[model samples]
Target: MPKLSNDKNSVCSLAQKQCCIRSLNSIRCDSGVTSAKAGRSCEGDDGNSCMDDSYQVCCSCCALGLWMRRQGQGCDADLHLGPSCGHVFLTCCEEVEARSQLPLRGQENLKPTVLPRRGNGLCSQRCSTAGGRVLCSCFPGFFLMKDGHTCEGEAQYYVDECAMRKDRCGKDFLCENTPGSFKCIPKQKCLSGFTQDAHGNCVDINECSSLAQPCSSSFACVNTVGSFNCQQKVLVCNRGYHTSPDGASCADVDECQMGSHACGVGQICHNLPGSYRCDCQTGYQFDALRKVCTDVNECWSYPGRLCAQTCENTVGSYLCTCTAGFILASDQKNCEDINECDQKPCSQECVNMHGSYQCYCRQGYYLHEDGLTCEDIDECSQSIGKLCAFQCVNVVGSYLCACPPHGYVMSANGHTCTDVDECKVGSHNCSSEKTCFNLQGGFRCLSFDCPHNYKKVSSTYCERINCAPNSFDCQNSPLRITYYTLSFQSNILTPAQIFRMGPSPVYAGDHVIISITSGNEENYFSTRKLNSFTGAVYIQRKVREPKDFLIEVEMKLLRRGTVTSFLARLYVFFTPSSI
Candidate 1:
């Protein structure tokens, strides 16, 4: 077999005839003719019938190899000098026959040849055939790269479709981006009780107006963010009714327990079901105008008819009192008289007065100094001769008769006394010539006559005779006669006369001087010359001692050639004063 040319550019630079044949054997053009000349003839020469000329045949196959290269096909032939011209033509003709089986117009270069796929790690899908070569592409949701051979997954983010293509979606719709592409959906699909805002988001629903109201008649509907709720209303109670603790239910109100009643002081309030009443207590009566209880005075109702003597009225009661000499009985309404002499308060006799008593003594006795005791009266000493005859003796409440010492007896009158004549009764002891005399207390009998210097005045009675002249010491004698002796108590209020002494016969030329000679001297007793013949003694001061005072007052008289003197004694008994 002959070898064909392997130089592609040189082979394709030939005429268009027989372009489909490439593989062919080689031949010698008349033993020395060159291969270039043979190639030239095959390019333009048309061969006629020949007696199996190898050079002409070989040149026809060479022209076929160049035509195949010009049609952009590969040639697998070796171009070298050989004696295989018929076998090369047969091989070229077989390839031409295989390509001719396709459609004749657009299928001129088309073939059903198998394409070898490329090994691309970045390809995300299977390989496909295009124009007799393998192409790498992506699966669904992916895209091809710029080199047109590798594939990648689609992008997850959205892109502005309007910015890219202004009319991407129509006016009634909005463009919504998907993972790899975009679509157009309706602008709004809002739910019930909800509305879309300007920015295309669903907000809350106002059930108070737009939808049906869900609250009751006594309740109110409130709207919230995307929801609504119902609230119950506050209920009001009527008069005498109050709301319960839960502020929903109504209950009856008790005015008495709540201290809302109009009861006054001292009035009791009684509670009823829905009202209250007032009542008064005992000893009190209700007053309509004052709405209170008033006290009733029972004492002033019946007056004095309730008591016997005197009636006094008090609050709800009365009192009684009796008159003089009477007392109130235990019944508190009656009076009883009292007996004043009931206890016998007198010693002898008791006489009842109206409200007192009087006491008296018996006939033989008299009321004592205390008036409650009786004592005897000494009648004999009270009246001397009227109570007795000769001598009176006092007895209890009476007098008795008594006799004298010389033998007297009582007369018929119990208080008289009489003397008996001794000679007539023969009770005397006189002789025949001797005379006996009877006296009240005694009787005497004479025996001798009196002397010459004394004369007998009566039997058994004699007195002293006058003194003789010059027979007495008249001037010098210390014994002077006391004419009158006087005794008096020392009770002189002022300078008063206690005693007086004077000469017996006052003469015209007589003069007397008097002086207190004894006693406590002039401290108690004093004297004064009253005239020329008399002298007077007096108390000088108040006597303070309970003793006897013997005051001697001396008087000296100057007479006609004779001086006579006398002394006066004053017995002043200084007894205690009564006051």
Candidate 2:
């Protein structure tokens, strides 16, 4: 029975005689393998310790008296029943961790030891389907059972650094793999505004404006994804609303009068941030000093362009300029009607009012163009005031009931002064021998008929021919008469003493007839045709010793021809009587 060998020098000389027979039965041999036969097996030895030492050679192998206890052998102190109950006992307990190295049994063919060990004890070690089935040894997250029947230090691998990354767990994990363990468990998310935070890591929960959304009566609640939708954004659905799906619910955005928003038209709507604007119920706004939407420019309450042409800007404000000659109206603000009669501006009749227009002129007229329109101006044609002093007459709109023509009358009210009598109502024919005077505003006709010896001197008097027969004697006999008359009526004398007269004046004894009488029929020639002169009526001849009687008078001067006028009458007749 001792010839058995897995040869390595016969198993190192039978492992030194099986360690000197378990140190002479002081027993302690277990590096695992066993089988039994009335065994006291400190487990480990393939052929089942050589088939239990071949029955210990037929019974000596501790035959029932159980004594193969080696190493300093102190035999049998417990776990009894070792007396061949068909001889099978197995025990193995191991602890070898010193830089670990245990890789033994592999000559291949060994499989049937189907695991079943739960802390069993006994030196009855039959863990042998050929040497690898003696199991028991553990430590770092352990697990070993190839029929080595169980050794488990596991359950400790929750090692979380988000290991192996599969959907990264931890909101209460669920990745469970056991052998060398792996765990995590709880997952199912979906909340923020109702959906889609697709694992960018949980926690987001918006449920769309939250409060479980059933919105609609003027509704609202926008929480997407895991559910909540309903939105009719504004107005009407009072006391706890319940109509949804476009009918409205949750109600209350009316920040103050909102057909939903845009507060403009006497405004008010202020929900804030995610939307809602327009504001003006406290006396209006955005008018930043009349920049628009209005309520304030109080015209600055005091000074400037505020309304002469218009500026009525009020509410919180304004007034003034709504009347004179008017202008303002394009909203420079208020008081309009500026048709100052359509801008023709007006020199006269323009009175349009509201903001202003009144230039005046129509009764018997006055004003032309500059004040604009009511023109009709003829104060008798611009004679304005001197009015007909001499000629003016321009009527239609005014002036001219005339005056000035020697007799001057127009004063009964056609604007003026009177006096045209030429002497008491006979209206002047003057010559039944003179005088008709009524002056100041015209009339004076006077005639005296002082011819024959000329001496009236009253009634517009006359005195010429002072002749008492002083000596213009002519005896040439056609009548033998020698008459010389008194001189007289004279604008100074000699056209032959004016046709040989003595009073109507013309001398030298008359009969020296010289005739070409046309200075307007030259009778006393009406004062030389009233001073526009060139008068001459003549007859000449009286020259016999008067020491100086050169009375030469020949005439005709209209385009001039034949004319003479000489008069040297020094007929003093003698005057040296005394010193």
Candidate 3:
């Protein structure tokens, strides 16, 4: 036998020669070591186990031959035994010594190895004891030991057999793992609208024909790959209809605003759901079943009410016409009154009303009966004494102011009478011998004092009243008489006779009386006294016939009962005019 040393200088050939001498089954481990069989003591050495020259250590007697063969030297190859023969082995001595120092099973130490290895092949986890026997075991993911000492890997780790060798299965099959071998199953997958059968083949599913399909009765289902479609049915609408918002129903179309109505001009279109109507506008009406608009006789509709003057009917409308003096107004329906007075038609004042005008006058004027003309009012005749202070003279529309007979002027307010001073305006008819005196409405005259015997006879002069009866100027010269001969043709157209008789220097007390005598009996001849002291003769006649006449005139003077007589002769002749 050879002994193994821990020296680094040992020769390798020395272990090969000595390791062949011992039998592999003869080695055993002692009790009291963790890798040894419990209750077994070694027969070779105390605490000593087998260690060959190849550095193979054996803590059990059964693995000595198998452990030596694995070193690949010239060792025993005929000792054929299974790992189940219960043995444990190690290659290094240091690992065996370290595991032997652990406390034995059921010892009171806290870090004790409670169950030791059964036959020296160390288990991956622990060993348990039961019924006075020891069995080796691994963790939960591993298996029980076959060698009564050690455990191998788990069996759930499936091997990839196809990856290693592709011919493990046929082309139409899939490879799956079993405990120690693999199986070939056929490959298949169903399409979208199909399902798988028990025979491992894809089959078509009729979604449209099946009762359990997702499509409703109102819809149609379409089949696709692995799916189906639920489509709503289309609804057909009438001529003037369109689809509803839901896209499944129909609704009517309005044609009024859409310009589909057949209404003509002057007509209005009214729309219904499926039809339209034509109607006439205001101020117009449809004729006897006519389609277009026609004129409406408003004048005839309401008799005598359309206009104040004339009402005329036109095409589709009516007109209101006024007479000559009036005009139309703004509102076409109602006839408004025109203001004819806007042009100042009246002479004085104008008033306007419906379709007419009126003329009025001021205070002193009146409206004529013609209703348009104005005339002046005769205020003088109407208001007699009230018009002026004294008298009223009528003018066209007014009255004139007059004063009394004196030299008077009218006042500014023509109704008041006023007085004027004749003395100041030189209007008095007074002589040189008299003095004028102013009085109300007139003037007065006063003569100067005459001589003692002459009494004032007039305002201008005075004559002497004392005279001698027969003196040269006494008795007014006895009423001196004068004679003259006169001739007149029958054609003389004069109606007066001319003769003069007077005595100069006559006294005022003398009296003369003249008369016609003898040839004056026809009364065509006559005489007149020229003054109180003188006499004159005059004759006048219309000599219608051719005749000759002799006339006599007498003059007499009477003073103090003495009479003086005087005679004068007058002759007349007629000459006939040839017819």
Candidate 4:
């Protein structure tokens, strides 16, 4: 066994070599003391020969004690591991001390032999030795690296203390992170219309109460959300004037345009800048006390000088009127005599006088009891001798002689009657197919005709002669042809019945068809059956001018299974409307 010396330098020199030996052997010592025998005591400055197992164990314990002391841990009292240590411990101890004092190096270079039981390891920040392994962690603003032995700065692996609920900021403060640390700042900043209180809260600023004379003398200041408003004051103006929009001035009001003036009838109102004037109309006088316009009576004021005749006074004017037989002249102030004859007041004649008129009658008339009317003399009854050779008639202001109603007319002497030649004068209503013969008081229309294969049987009827059994021409021809004449004025209405053809004595189940066979080229006539036995023809179109139509109406009668046709020669005449 080797003996250890009592000299501090020699002992420390021996402890360094032994510590290295223990480290190489992977041994651990908790109290900086190894579990080995005490080494042999080595004297003097030469302790190199003290290599005993006990001395080596004791020296290793001494070296560890010195290192622990440099790390701010007290060394074992028995080791004397202060500045008095020898060169053996000084070299290794100095090296260990140098490494421990250096700033936090990388994880690979940081190695500590003995660490504290709880939070002590080769870590940049917090450390733990749990389950025989060194684990590292960081503070609120720092983060642990992958090595589990080092902590990264806040800039590299940033940790949001606010988001992670690890900040120490108050409720009114905002937490902001920095390198390896955290900061607290006020949460809100005061803005316009708001002020910050002692507790850092924003409160509304009452500008209306805070400012001096914010509004003018005529306005009232009112505070609003984030602003202020000034409202105008109410004002009253004098009569004939009104307040302006801003309540700062006054403006004039027009009484005439607004119809507010107290001007009476017959007065005109005129407007001034701020007042009105009332004036009287023509022929009216204004009464100042009554404030009204009164009519001027010219008749009483100027009498004869104003009008030539009568004078009258009216509201706002005067009038000049004439007498009963005179009129007002164009000058409106004089009168003139009216020509009464221009009005034709008399039945026969009229004559004008200075201011009146006269009425008279002609030779065949006499003035009535009324001076304006003239009545006939009735010469037909009042005459003393025969005045006419025919009947006498009286008319207005004259007398005349009239002939009989037919076949007679008055001669040129206007008193003798003469026969009228109806045929020569063409006055009879006879068609072209008939002859008109004059008689004593009337005229006669005669028509005589016989168609081919027919012979006259009577004055108006024609009979067919003998024919062969198979002669269709003689058989089909009318067995009897009758003549008819119709007369109408041109003013007759359309659709007039002109002729009716049917059997004289009819039996049952008798039907006839009537049609205008000729002289209806203009389609003016049509036929219709009134009953089974009677058929009639009508003038369907109006004849506006005097005309004649000779239509042959044929009626085919079917009676008792026998068919026989008859012909009627109708002569239609339209005379003048006056006849």
* All candidates: CA RMSD (Å): 54.5, 40.6, 46.6, 34.1
Off by over 4 Å in 2: 1-243, 246-249, 253-294, 301-579
What is the C-alpha local distance difference test score of each model? 0.50, 0.35, 0.49, 0.60
What's the residue-level lDDT of 133 in candidate 1?
55
Tens digits of per-residue lDDT for model 3, 432-462: 7656644334455543455443444443234
Model 2 lDDT vs. the true structure? 0.35
lDDT of 2 at 12: 14
Candidate 2 lDDT over residue span 306-370, tens digit each: 55333445575565554443445566543444556576567534534323444544334444445
The model with the greater lDDT, 2 or 3, is 3
Poorly placed runs, candidate 3 (over 4 Å):
1-226, 230-232, 242-261, 283-293, 304-310, 320-343, 350-355, 360-579
Expressed as tens digits, the lDDT of each residue in 92-153 for candidate 4 is: 34444343453343123322232111112344433334566544444332345676644434
Candidate 4, residue 261: Cα displacement in angstroms equals 99
lDDT of 1 at 538: 70
Which sections of candidate 1 miss by over 4 Å?
1-475, 483-490
Comparing 3 and 4 by TM-score, which wins? Answer: 4
Ranking by TM-score: 4, 3, 1, 2
Using all chains and alpha carbons, the TM-scores for the candidates as numbered come to: 0.19, 0.17, 0.26, 0.27
